[model samples]
Target chain A: MEDNVKKIMHVMRRAPHGSIYTYEGLEMILIMAAYEQDLSIAFIGDGVYALKKNQDTEGISMKGFAKTFMALDGYDVEKLYVDRVSLEERGLTEDDLLVDVELLDSVEIGRRMTEQDVVIHH
Target chain B: MSHRFLATILNSDKVKIGILLKEGPYNHQAADTAYKFAEAAIKKGHTVDAVFLYNDGVINATNLTDPPQDDRNIADRWSKMAKEHGVEILACIAASKRRGITDDIMIDGGSITGLGTLTDIAIRNDRLLTFGD
Candidate 1:
């Protein structure tokens, strides 16, 4: 069967304080899409922490889960996003992030989500 | 806008669909459904442009993943599907970094763009879906 040319979007909402699996799961999908197929990403709620800067995981050293983010460029898996409201709620601004991010409010994020061929929430 | 018109517009050919994964696929059933749905759409002749990974969803690209033999390796499966097809996978650089998903070594296909790219994909695409945990 012929394949349709559509776009996929992945949204993240979990915080980093708990488990790294949530963030990692999202990473796996992006790698698959950017490297293998085609896809994109978005952030909302507590998920904004996935992009914070100077995480200082050294104190806990729980496998350095956030470090995997640097690999995005190599995989051509760009498209990092954040939730404006979520970020503000956590007292985090774009400046506090370790990587570059595009912040969107709930309404804007919702509008953007409708543009994808498929959306998977992790 | 009327539901009929909106549905027609969303379902139009010019529309591209985007899926958002807010939690880890292991914890989120919606994520699994979305992936399956995308594959189904492709088999149905629908084109899936890009699959963006932000926040917790960024973990999908982690190379260190090692799911059990019996369990479905969602990450690897997605990678294989993307490779077989022409799907674009994206990871939120900030989200990944915050969660400690750094690229000590270089991998292919994946990138570290920005949220604007997601917006561009959404605005340009026909449909955007979210599989929230």
Candidate 2:
């Protein structure tokens, strides 16, 4: 029922352009966000790169979607999270990201994941 | 008493499952694994409402896929399961269009649908399991 707002979390674990998973994953997220469900996104591993600042896909002939992350808040899908260990392992910090995301430890992320009604990983 | 009895049955212990497969057949084990999981669940008396195809998973709904004589036809495998078990096998329209999979070429017991349908599957089912890289 629309009355039960589901806690759905989309987990991004892949890098952009390596395959269409991250991009398609994002597309799925946007569509679900319109359902008025409680939605959240988590970036781990290479997925953190999707939010990296200054992505250039012109040379690869791919439509740049990094900027799309910034517009997600306009959809009311504001719970963007990043794995702190994943960012630091890649020598990145909050400043390296193109969107404002909550830096969460693995434990915190796992706890959030457990509370979700559904978790989709890409 | 009647209301309490109806509520008891409505809250059945069996899970209602919805599967999302993102990989194509053969190249990845996601399709096979999802099929087996669905089969096992149905055997255990659970309800497997649908299997939604996204990404290259749309490839699984095409009858044009023909493997060698000795090989397992993955497309046929899905078709058979859908026919025998009455499970809804759906492929995303946008993904299918991108891959050139039209309704005319779709395997038996499968249909082309949209992401909005996927949203329904995710919301209506008790469990939504995703299989992909």
Native contacts, share recovered per candidate: 0.30, 0.52
lDDT of 2 by residue, A40-90 (tens): 999999999999999999999999998889999999989999999999999
Off by over 4 Å in 1: A1-122, B1-15, B104-108
Docking quality (DockQ) of candidate 1: 0.16
lDDT of 1 by residue, A53-105 (tens): 77766677565556666566566667777888888988888898766667777
Clashing pairs in 2: none
Provide per-model DockQ scores: 0.16, 0.71
Candidate 1: lDDT over CA atoms? 0.68
lDDT of each: 0.68, 0.92
For the record, the alpha-carbon RMSD of candidate 2 to the native fold, in angstroms, is 2.3
Error of 2 at A29 (Å): 0.9
